[model samples]
Target: MHKNLSRWREGEQAGRRYAFTAPSPTRYPWQWYWDSCFIAIVRSRWDRERARRELESLLAVAEDGFIGHIAFWGRPLDLERAVRYNVVRRRDLTTRTIQPPLLAYAWRIAVGDPAAEPGIAAHHRWLGGHRDLDGDGLLWLLQPDESGLDASPKFDHVWGPRAQGRRRFPLLIRRNRALGFDLRRVADAGGPVVCEVLTNVAWSLSRQACGEPSTTPALVARLWDERTGRFVDEARGAVHRPLPPERVPFTWDTLAPLALPDLPEEIGRRLVEETLLSERFWPGVPLPSVALDDPAHTSRDHYWGLRRYWRGPSWANAAWLAWQGVRRLGYRAEADDMARRLGETVVREGLREYYEARTGAGMGARDFGWTALALEMLSPRAGSGSGSA
Candidate 1:
């Protein structure tokens, strides 16, 4: 564990452009929002000053409370590539959409108070206004990539063949970015627009941590499906109903709301009993990104084709969040079991981007930042206690 943590420390970049942990030295090459959040959480356990610096660097680039999904090292070619691929526009160095509002949540944990930070309060305020797209108090994902699940089946249909087809990739990227990278605009473009469950939950948790009012009540009223015992994605715009259960993509992201420490008892209990402990999600390596039974579920060896990315890999970051949520809800035994399993996977597979859900085989970038973060979080010094929700 100490060796893995050393790799993460060695991976840190400091001095000018940004003092943040890169997700990986090779594949990722830049600082990502949520990745930094998790990284800070782990860093706080040992080095509070460095953890705080990591977040402060992110806020340094914030524009009107909107932190771009990723911050590059500002090379001319990188900037040109981002604009050409529509990953980011000329006006901003970051991507078109924001990542999960997890910075505040991590801030409160790393520092004593989230609002104590220079720009955090403003960012929190920015989210309360701009991100509530439909005014239902639930946040919407402007693009599938913003959800951080990327190529998950939840977005397979919404992104369509353009997302998978190499020929159409550039066109799809431009179209999504041109639409302001917003779900409402996608709806306007005759594409499916979903009020993502995980993004809103992360937003609400950030609000709570920052001493802002709770948005979970409004989110529950808006997205929780009492009949289904799960939080379902609601379509944006005039369709004010949760999508059908069959239509809703069952993935680890769908259950992310479970991580909220203050989640209502009834809602959280139903989620634990019906979904988290069920055969669909709790079996095999456990908490597979896509349920094992889902037709879209893919194993690590199968990731080479159109069905790659978040289709079925068990991401340590996702598992860490879920473990924190479960522990917060007083399920210490279950949470500890999950943490142990994830720690073992990292030890056996090395610090990779993610692991195959069932086999625990490492995949994607090795020495991955977030995977190392997870190991640190589960380390003895970090303790098994829950984090700020």
Candidate 2:
């Protein structure tokens, strides 16, 4: 396992060095905040000075308190023309869309210290600027598709215009009609349900920003499904269940009350334990966006970039996030067990963007975000009890 891990880490470092040169000597490609955050997390384990530079670099790219989404080599991707769909344009500069407010949490984990006063204050101010608290107080996400890499079909609906200029990938679905693999026909397929990790993260951040009492009524209402005793994807409305059932068990959903200091403890605990760990939800792969039980699990036969579909694959980021929340609530034994399981699986199967839920087989970009996440978790410098961040 150690040998495999070392080889994988070398591959990841090489990929990063080659694929990601600072777009410019001075500027950054779109603000790539979450990506930068993750890079910093891993880099901190290797080189604290460079990790610090990565954060400072992100700050360098911020404009009007928000990070732009697309930065070319090091400069911002040029958005000189009106954004168009299916048309090749000049420089693509549509960076307003945001991912999760994971920078602060990830920074705390990576830096291994409480953020300084200015650093903490700056992040909070930026969070406030980005948060949309209308009269009703519901935190409306202007562009929900900013949670990079969930690979949902419905993203075109919510973020069509902003996402237009970006490269688009074909979504292929295959169904076994009790005959064989038929790529032509797929049943019960529609646009993807909302699977935004950042929106959920925003809910978590809001609680942290507000002193960790209770989730605001608006955020709670967005996620609440009184009938199921669980949070559903907000964009899908009440009709659609949250895809990736395994993640639903993640303490993020339960931590909502703790973060906001709202909701009944019993309700949160029940949802955390029963539904999240239920056989129907927990896939053999362990980290699926859509659980093993979902009908759509096998429908998407291929992945973006001609790669295989990881939409249903178990992912390290989701697992690490779950580990953090679980341990925070003092579920130490459970945390250790989960970390060992997820880490061992990634090490054994080889790191891919995701893993097959039923088979534990790995697939997707070889050294992608999920794979890098696993490496970061295994890095000894990631800190004790810091299963994954």
Candidate 3:
């Protein structure tokens, strides 16, 4: 625990432009939207002021309630030259698309309920106005990065080479405009138009926490696959179709709706009994990003040889969210056991970006922020509340 705390303190960065926690100093050197939220939630356990500042720095740069997925700290020209996707590049050293809306949940946890109100309202308004691309009451995820599950198989068909081109780029821009954005969208759109489960669940959890009406019903109607008894990624265009069990495997992201405390009993039961506790996801470590039986599962090697960035890696943040859901649904022993195993793995392997599902081998960036943050979740002082779904 002392080692983890020391690593976290070392990752803290304060600059003229931003004061926040970077997920990893060597790997991720910028302020990421959802990462900061998780960091702040954990930081609240020991340092309230730093926790508040972690979120406030991100909110300080929000435009019309849309916080960039990542805020770069250096000069604009240097960033502009390096960033290939125009959609993510901004004049003020930030990305354009927002990450999962976990800020509201984080703010309520780190700051007080009253202090979180304005940002919550503004962010909710912005999402409703600019992200509900098809007027389906649920928001659309433009890219896999926006959903925070970058290389999941759910988006495999959507982001393939065939989806890229000049024609699709303009349609994407038009779609953004129709959805209420004033700026021009510059990236080519070939990725699937998904009403991502995590994004919607996060939004719903945040709304409910803020005393706003829940959007779970709308989300269920859009993504719930009655045939599979799970939430599958629903594509907007006819470019994709539902796959058979042998070909397309269920991923942890599909079960993200379980994180919602108010999830319907029947749906939640199916998730816990039929999936999470089953051999599919509960193999050994608890919650892997991809199920072991899934055809797309890859336990060795990281994405692009950099690090295991979410593909078949077990993440503490995701596991902690699942633990909260399990505890909320009365699986006290199961949740506690899972939490204990996670803490043990982190302690043994040291703080890392993620871990190998079965072996618990530490992977990715070392001295990671969220890896250290997981210790706080395991501590007795941690509150029983929903974090990033």
Q: Whole-model Cα lDDT per candidate?
A: 0.70, 0.45, 0.68
What is the alpha-carbon lDDT for the whole of candidate 1? 0.70
Q: Evaluated with TM-score, which candidate comes out highest?
A: 1
Task: Tell me each candidate's TM-score.
Answer: 0.87, 0.64, 0.84
- Ten residues in a row with the worst lDDT in model 1? 5-14
Deviation (Å) of 277 in candidate 2: 1.3
lDDT (tens digit, per residue) of candidate 3 on 134-234: 66668776655578876566566665432222224334434554444332121233334667888898888777767777788888887787778877766
Model 2 TM: 0.64
| Cα deviation of 381, candidate 3, in Å | 4.6
In candidate 1 the C-alpha lDDT for residue 346 amounts to: 82
Deviation (Å) of 357 in candidate 1:
0.8
Candidate 2 per-residue C-alpha lDDT over 95-188 given as tens digits, one digit per residue, 9 for 90 to 100: 4445665555555655644345255456556645444433333333433334544344333343332222224421111112121211112112
Q: Model 3: which residue pairs collide?
A: 163-190
What is the C-alpha RMSD, rounded to one decimal, of candidate 1? Answer: 3.7
Model 1 clashing residue pairs (backbone): none
Candidate 2: where are CA atoms >4 Å away?
1-31, 75-89, 92-94, 112-127, 130-138, 142-144, 153-197, 206-218, 236-268, 299-310, 330-333, 375-389
Q: Residue 280 in candidate 3 has what lDDT?
A: 81
